[model samples]
Target: MKCPLCGCEKAHKHGKTSKGGQRYLCPHCKKTFTDTFDTIYYRRHLNTDEVHSILQSHTEGSSLRGISRITQRAYGTVVSLVRAASQKAQIVHNAKVQKIKTKEVIGNEMWSFVEKNKKPVSQKN
Candidate 1:
């Protein structure tokens, strides 16, 4: 395995995580990291299918509490998952939208001025 911290290919098995994923140790960087390090799923207990279900339910107009009840997850977990997903989507949107080129823009404007006095200025004076 390769060491993620130092980009070294001399990594050895250090231990196993609580979830049974193998942990690697890098001699060069003297650091221990797992295969999931730095990933969105890192440290997350929920599996992919569960998270997908939660997001799908949320997009289908399910409330956080309702999602929690439906998915059998805690309400706080549902809220946090939704918030994290929203943040990720916003970031992706900003990145992709920046690359789009605007071909054309159609617009119009009108300008007008109104006077309180209806009489001609010369006649009023």
Candidate 2:
């Protein structure tokens, strides 16, 4: 694996993270990083399935509080995950939408006009 810090190709197996993920050490920069480095799952305590479940529930119209309650996670954790997911989605959307080519577009607009008839009634004295 390439070193994330110095972009060096000489990286060795440093150790394993607490979660059993492989860790690498870059001899060029003397930096140690895990396999999850620079990834969405980096430094996250929750496992992959839990993170997926949280994101899925958020997309499925579940509120943060609701997801927290259902997942038994802290409210702060749910909020943080939701924010991170939103940012990542925005990044992906920007990247993918920039490559789109548009030709012709069809659209419709509706206009309504309301008129009230005004008639003066003769008053009986």
Candidate 3:
């Protein structure tokens, strides 16, 4: 595997981590890392699919406790994962989002009122 820090190939297996993850050593950069290095899964017990499920639940408006119960993980773990995902999303948004001046902006209160109070046509007509 290649080193995450240097992106150098030809790295070889060095040892196993305390958690039994295979570790690779890079000769080019003298850095040691695992398959999950620099990723959200790094040092986390939850796998990628588990992390994805948590994120999906969060997007679906599930509460932290609810997510914990659904995923069979601790409440604190749910919060930590949500926070990490939020931070990562924020970084990506800050990097890729652009600001533009607009003449008018719609507020949430107006949108909610409009959404909940739609008028209906006369049934007889």
Candidate 4:
């Protein structure tokens, strides 16, 4: 396959990493890549299917450590992904809020600030 970054067709399999991921070298661009290129976990050594399974487990209410154990990923990485996904979901939900000026416009900046500072509690703990 051609190198996705530079569209270089002159590529060859360099070697495999200790994690068993295949590595490729592009002679045209002098760049190295693995199977995870153009993906969220491109630089990560974790398996693509394993990461997807971890994400699925997180979505299904599994703990970050639990997902990490199942997928053989760092606990911190799993937690980071879970938190980032939750924040993205919250942002999307907030973006869809319709502005309805009922009883004239009201100022609630202080309350909003407080809400922002509120700690997010997990259902499991």
lDDT of candidate 2 over 1-125, digit per residue (tens): 89988999999998888778899999999999998786667888889999999888877778777889999999878877777766676688788867557798675432211134479898999
Count of steric clashes across candidates, in order: 0, 0, 0, 0
Task: Write the residue-wise lDDT of candidate 1 on 1-125 in tens digits.
Answer: 88877899999999898889999999999999998775556678799899889888887777777888988899778777777777676688788867656888664432211123376557544
Residue 41 Cα positional deviation in candidate 1, in Å, after optimal superposition: 2.0
lDDT of 4 at 38: 61
What is the lDDT of every predicted structure here?
Answer: 0.77, 0.80, 0.79, 0.70
Give the least accurate 10-residue stretch of model 3, judged by summed lDDT. Answer: 108-117
Please report the candidate that would top lDDT against the real structure: 2
lDDT of 4 at 88: 64
| Best first by lDDT, ranked | 2, 3, 1, 4
Model 2 weakest lDDT span, ten residues long: 108-117
By TM-score, the better pick of 1 and 3 is 3
Off by over 4 Å in 1: 1-13, 95-97, 104-125
Q: TM-score for all predictions?
A: 0.62, 0.73, 0.63, 0.49
**Against the true structure, candidate 1 has what lDDT?**
0.77
Residue pairs whose backbone atoms clash in candidate 3: none
